[model samples]
Target: MRAHADAFIAYATDPDPRVRRASIEGLGLFLEDAERAVGLLQERLVHESGVAERVLVVQTMADLVLRLPAAAAPARAWFDALADSGSTDADTRLAALAHRARCAPDSIDDRTVPVVIELLRRVTPAPPPEQDPAPDDRRPSRCVHVRPRRRAIRLFPGTSPQHSTTSNATAGSMPPTPLLKALHEALGARFDDRKALLTEQLRSADRATRYDAIDMARRLIASWRGDHTDLAVHSPM
Candidate 1:
């Protein structure tokens, strides 16, 4: 696989979605080379033929971010753009919601909270029996031939009509149960003095200040996670 990496990397842009997806999945095996690997994978997000393929590009990028956190700012920005995109569809809004939350947590109180609540109401325990078996998009997989059917035309809660457009493209709904569970957990999670601390995370320009703010938040998430970007990526980079 190491010897053939160049060929496989080239295949990430292949005309076939299957090849593109497999190539992205294969790229995951080379996270140690963060600069080259992330550079290669970043372009694929735009070139991917479909959302499912794009998400693989993302997931693989995420794995790389675990190795090179400096690469995260751009990816985080991309997810927020996807979420806040006025021209993007509700499915995109739905897909980008959690990620946007991760990227721009400040929006949770102002914008995303309402959008998520509304999305929760429309969500079914399953993907409606009919849509249950549709091809999964957010995860990379071997089954790339199947096409996704358009799901419901969900709302983007607070988007003033001018800021949002309805996405009519056919795509399967993300499984609702896990989504609901995650949201519920988020809702239930405890936070002490979030306003003061989160404001610092969002405002401070100093990398160290931002790092400290984020580390405080992580201490809340789990003590074992370690320093984020300001601390730098682990492993041989």
Candidate 2:
């Protein structure tokens, strides 16, 4: 990987937007030199014209902060800034939360849990009825049930989080989002307070809150048993 570091750096500014974003995503994986990698990401953030690269930069920075203890403070500050900013795009804004979850889980309190839980809720338009129109004037057909009006419904699909390499938060990796991963960290080791906060979330009357909390626990236990294959959260839409 080190041998191709220079190529990846150069490709970060490729003329093709797709190549540029792909290279940016690839650069985050090369963790040989943390500071240098971060510097390059910052530079790319300025030069990039599209939201995709910017989102990549933000997500990569979060991954860096998570892996390299030295990448905190500055990176965390940037995440907080973006998260708080009204102008921030949805993916970058959500990616910002990853820094809080992974690098500063202890900072998460009751106020923070609601925001994180909010991330798990997916706002999707309700689907049309699975049943088709009845043959006659709807003569008491079992299939002719009351279809939900065409309106948006909230799904607790664990709001927009992504794997480090995934550029799109809304449409990310098979693994649970960064939020889920952060909750995984909370279950043991350094985040006792975070664990307590999440434990409280499990009892919330709101089904979305409880579902996300349970999913977090599910991911935590799966990781403990060395079971990565079962971490995918199927959306109950």
Candidate 3:
């Protein structure tokens, strides 16, 4: 356990996106030492680039707070400052607001309300128009048709399809981003209203909205029963 935790801490900054994500999720194992985990995550946030990584770190901190409030005081303070800081990037601030809303609603008021409202209103930009295909690309090429002869099939009398496989176990799994995971943990079992809202967002035409909705749903279901066992098993790694 110690070795794995150490490896995850090192891989937090790994160049590969999958590795980084797995490492971030693995940090949840340190929930028993919230201060240490939160502090490490905060440090990673400062150095982390990319939207996904930032979102995950913020969500993980929120999850820590929700699961271990007494031990997550430092994490709460960190979010408070991040949300209020003018120099922080817009996305990070948005994540901070979302985390606070999920884990500590009372902390949100007039000052943060407008910010959250604005973030929810933000939209992804439309993609640029594609160039028309060249004239030669307009039609399919003509080819001679030939029917191939069928080969004899061999029957394994005792064998059927391998229906019982690990593939089936993973079919319904959708790993949530860090932010979504935190929201799920924080919301606990009372997420009907939030679930409905996220479902609406899932149907949105905007790519960003859809992405957020999917991530949120993944986490919501993962922590639905307030059991972190499965979530831990499928952590980013």
Best by lDDT: 3
Estimate the TM-score for candidate 2: 0.55
The RMSD (Cα, Å) of candidate 2 is: 8.6
Please provide, for model 3 over 70-145, each residue's C-alpha lDDT reduced to its tens digit, 9 standing for 90 to 100.
6457877888898888887666776787788787866645455456434443322233567999998999878878
TM values, all candidates: 0.46, 0.55, 0.54
Clashing residue pairs for model 1: 149-171, 150-170, 150-171
**Model 2 bad stretches (over 4 Å):** 31-33, 46-54, 118-137, 140-179, 183-237
Q: Which pairs clash inside model 3?
A: 22-236, 22-237
- By summed lDDT, which 10 consecutive residues of candidate 2 come out lowest? 165-174
lDDT of each: 0.48, 0.55, 0.58
Q: Pick the candidate with the highest TM-score.
A: 2
lDDT of 1 by residue, 34-92 (tens): 56776677677655546566545555654555556666676566667766776654444
Candidates, ranked, lDDT: 3, 2, 1
- Badly placed stretches (over 4 Å) of model 3 are 1-3, 126-237
Q: Least lDDT summed over 10 consecutive residues: which range in candidate 3? A: 163-172
